[model samples]
Target: MAQGPPPPSTPVELLTNKGIIEEPFVNKFWGPALFGTFTFIGVCVSNWFTRRPVFAGIQKHIILSGTAAVIGKFVDDYRAGYLAERDAVLRHYIELHPADFPPFERKKFADVLEPWVPIR
Candidate 1:
């Protein structure tokens, strides 16, 4: 005898895949799918608006994108509490290795980011 495959990522995903969490609906499957689908639709809508008046719809897209990012972030944070935990671990690591990470200098900002910017 042998195993077939690995397990699912999250508890909700696992339950939904196995047909265990079948009641009214499958929250795990629908939640991310709907969120991503709507987010992409929102971008398309913004693009549609943008085509009408050159750069007029740009600001709308920016705001909408920002809103989507914030909402998605909030959902992930609420679900996993990753931010605080990662911050705590990072803080501890920094404390343990103060010499490895140097303090930021305002003068070096341009030097740090200039290469990434396009030439033209």
Candidate 2:
């Protein structure tokens, strides 16, 4: 009998199926996962340095930028459904820690952040 094409046999093999590669990588949480992890680590290091009197040059901009990056990842993942579970957890935490978030104030960030974050 003639041999048919070999069947996909690995976890990665499923990616070869149609509509896999073409789909958004965020749906798999790869992009947000990497960005959030790196941003969090950098934020912690920057905050540590901020406490020292020697590194006066390391402005609070690091924390601001790092937070923006993390939020950006959350928005990206939420829109991608990668954060569906994550969002629930965050929402729960935020609910418990009401002081962490600011009142909903619209800002120019919506111009960029909105595009990345879908209305859901």
Candidate 3:
């Protein structure tokens, strides 16, 4: 049987339909959003202090935008490094202990990681 389109619904349903509700909030924020926000704020403060009087406005905007771009690229590279390193470790451990390691898509987990992981 052919299924009809979903009916108009409440706010939650609307959000779900738009994919906002279904999207993982933490995952979304971790990758680029959080990094970008931190970079923007950091650049703004630094530029505010260091910028010359006449060119301060233009410099501030340029600095913030540039910081975000540079930081975002750094974050991407950092994440790729972490993924490669983590996967290597996991593979090594699994090779040492076959019984403990279950076969699965290790790359999937690696791909979902953020640039910064606290080592403690």
Candidate 4:
């Protein structure tokens, strides 16, 4: 009996079927904020051990943490906005030139496209 075509094989089949993993929201903001807070606390403790005023530097720690949080938020927002813009552009292009994309794949991109908003 003739067997059908051999099943596909990979040189390293162990790596196949791996799925994408997303990062947690905490890593984007709280992680950086905590790191900054701890670093500033260490500095304050060091100053206290050296007979320097520790309270004077408390505001600095708060500012550093806030800054880190703000920066993290900005980075996250920018990334999301960038991806939205990219999808919008791609959808527009696909709509304008339907023949360029395969029919089977067009349905996957059928979601309503987001309007492009220029960054101020």
What TM-score, to 2 decimals, does candidate 3 have?
0.39
lDDT of 4 by residue, 58-84 (tens): 777678767766766677678777976
lDDT for 35 (candidate 2): 64
**lDDT tens readout by residue for model 2, 51-90:** 8443344445456556766776677756756645555666
**Clashing residue pairs in candidate 4, if any?**
none
Compared with the true structure, the alpha-carbon lDDT of candidate 2 equals: 0.57
* Per-candidate alpha-carbon RMSD to the true structure: 21.0, 19.8, 16.2, 16.8
TM-score of each: 0.29, 0.27, 0.39, 0.43
Stronger candidate by lDDT (3 vs 4):
4
lDDT of 4 at 19: 43
Error of 2 at 110 (Å): 63
Greater-lDDT candidate between 1 and 4: 4
Please list the C-alpha lDDT of all candidates, in the order they appear. Answer: 0.57, 0.57, 0.59, 0.62
Model 3: per-residue Cα lDDT over 3-119, one tens digit each: 755553332232223433354556544555565666666666766677744335766666666667667767777886797677666656656776664444325656897789789
Model 1 lDDT at residue 12: 28
In model 2, where do residues sit more than 4 Å from their true spots? 1-27, 52-120
Pairs that collide in candidate 2 are none
